[model samples]
Target chain A: MIITSKKAIMFVLSKIEGAVLMAKRGMLIVLSGPSGVGKGTVRKALFEDPEVDFNYSISMTTRNPREGEKNGVDYYFVSKEQFEENIKNGEMLEYAKYVDNYYGTPLNYVNEQLNAGHDVFLEVEVNGALQVRANCPDGVFIFLTPPDIKELRSRLVGRGTDDLEVINKRIQKASKEIRMMQNYDYAIVNDKIKNAVEQIKDIVKSERLKVNRVMPDYLDSLGDEI
Target chain B: MIITSKKAIMFVLSKIEGAVLMAKRGMLIVLSGPSGVGKGTVRKALFEDPEVDFNYSISMTTRNPREGEKNGVDYYFVSKEQFEENIKNGEMLEYAKYVDNYYGTPLNYVNEQLNAGHDVFLEVEVNGALQVRANCPDGVFIFLTPPDIKELRSRLVGRGTDDLEVINKRIQKASKEIRMMQNYDYAIVNDKIKNAVEQIKDIVKSERLKVNRVMPDYLDSLGDEI
Candidate 1:
């Protein structure tokens, strides 16, 4: 019996040591939502919350940015050649082309922020979120939607930027996106921006307490004691 | 152009109405963790805090009541015949036999608490938690573990109830439980009980603001005429 107790204690000590090592590693949070679901509004509100230190990720784009858009701030505008080079080098987490312009997430800024122990938020399309998940298996993925399909259509049309034809196309695209909601770790319906922001904020704040993210040492210590 | 704007307004209005309906539903939250990870300690702390109005669920069992165990206080002790009847009637969420005695969750009390707009916590085994999840898919699940396996084993052994053999058995069971941590909605490593309690409190506070849980009529008015 004494020997067994000693063995148990030794086993516990080794596990605790491993957990302490893992505590230093960072965790990633990914937010994805359908278009025109006020994801931007929610993000803005979240960033404004003083309690959270969030690192905003600027995307790399080959397209010409609009007026008052800075190279690094608005987007890391690069030449098509540079963009293609980064893609070949696997420096981008995910990339897509739109109207002959390429946009992608550059891995550097995100990694830097995560290493600094600050949570990073990525506002991306559904496809981009999925790609991030594939690359970073540990990332927390949240999918946002309007309360219902009817409301989603109205949000898209209410923007007044799209013509009827464009609006219809968006509605169809949203239908497809809504079906993918189950793939997310959590779903936040954009029925109320304030409420949705609170939900996302809660998810972010709660995620920090995850054993893998903040307490590997804690878990390891839960075993036998040396 | 005017027609396009009008259509958009109508769409937004309807979306808000739908959100209001979904908000009327009560939300469920499930709290689970390994034994001796201080889940009970954290829960008591949360209850003491004014912000948490959570109802604690007392399970029903067929085991004879021990001294000082009052009906509906510690548990609702029922005869084996009554428990079997409950099982036949689908009145229990989950049931299992331990040491030849049956323990199960009664659905009535849980539903009553939930319908009264209170978040009910069923401190049950993983099997029971799973059954609750199956019954209520929208319920949020939280799993707790110790900061390290060593700490957990220490806590278990420190209780002084079990000898080396019993402690070893618990340790083996815990290893299996750790593997199932991924099935949880959130994993909380209990290093400091106060800190862990705060984290869980934050989650409950934030989850209350979910779009589906909070009414959204105000949002529809954002785009409507005064």
Candidate 2:
């Protein structure tokens, strides 16, 4: 009877040790880039990976849903009245209007996801990304660019849908975006999808090793013993 | 005769290829830290592997050399007049006066070693590191730190060389330096010598892979083909 009770105690201690080892909080990664720079492709690759315990925060908007879009899954799809109310009530972190429609990020969902110990990624335009930084200064920012101006123009044209004038306008806009690249913490040149994704993964993995963010509190809680 | 001539051409091509593959450039890595952070131990371990091509850049001083010190190798041992003249002529990148003596980094030797493709390291105080940053903005800056305040004071007292009052003074000074930690580009906590050295090595290797610095101008020189 005594031997069995000792074995049960040992088993409980082992389980407790394992749980302690696994306790680690998640991070917030904010990815920003000019349009057509392949942020979506890289993000898609990350989403497909199982080892990463992270999720992209689906942004909420007041705009009408497009075909095949499901409410709360694709987006919250709130009415303009509700959205404006949330904005006034300080529920929206940042919001902007485009094409006569309102789009904004609901803060409650992001905070809930972060609290649940899952890293959240926000994929937004440069303006929205700047707003996120202003609100959450600790967020990591990554900027992406193409190999060169010619390649960027070629990629835009190769899409085969945009007219020549639209492509030219996009190219001009991209040039202006490139000028602001220096303000970013890190600039990734997306010459190849696979390599670019790998580089970004390395950055995120290495950032997790940063000393300041890694919890010294846990060590302190270990008390006078290891 | 024709066979011999072909063999000679092959040999020349192989030699040129080897030279291209072996081409390496030196870097200046400045390591700064708060007092009692164990940077010295990590630096010693780094030099243990001679193939790293790492050389510590010794600062020249106007102070009298200690017994058995070599003139150029240990320090430049410049006269006070020469040191002040170098400062006037912008030869000294950064300098400080202490105890009626002067210490400064000589610009010529550092650049000469860098041009010869050897990576130089400056183990300096935070103030000196900041000066280096201002003068040579491209050089890498690494700040070493302790795992926590408790560990830092423990290490300081564990040395057994300083009195209690002196240790307390150092602890106060260290906290001040730790507050300036964010000024550095990278900070590695010196928890253990081997771990810290590995972290530093990772940082150096990754910094070397920066795309903009490594992107050869030969691509542009190759004209529109790129």
Q: What is the DockQ of each candidate?
A: 0.26, 0.05
Interface RMSD for candidates 1 onward, in order? 7.6, 13.4
lDDT of 2 by residue, B1-226 (tens): 5456445434544544454455455678988887567776778787786546667877889999899988886678989999999999988767888789988788887887887877788777677888999988888888887555455555654565666557557656655556566667677778778877766766665555444444332122112312
Give me the displacement of residue A187 in model 1, in angstroms: 3.4
Extract clashing residue pairs from model 2. Answer: none
Q: Lowest lDDT 10-mer window, candidate 2 chain B?
A: B217-226
**Candidate 1 TM-score versus the reference:** 0.66
Q: Whose DockQ is greatest here? A: 1
Docking class of 2: incorrect
- Mind giving the per-residue lDDT tens digits that candidate 1 earns over A74-143? 6899999999999999899888888899988999888887776666788888888889999888887888
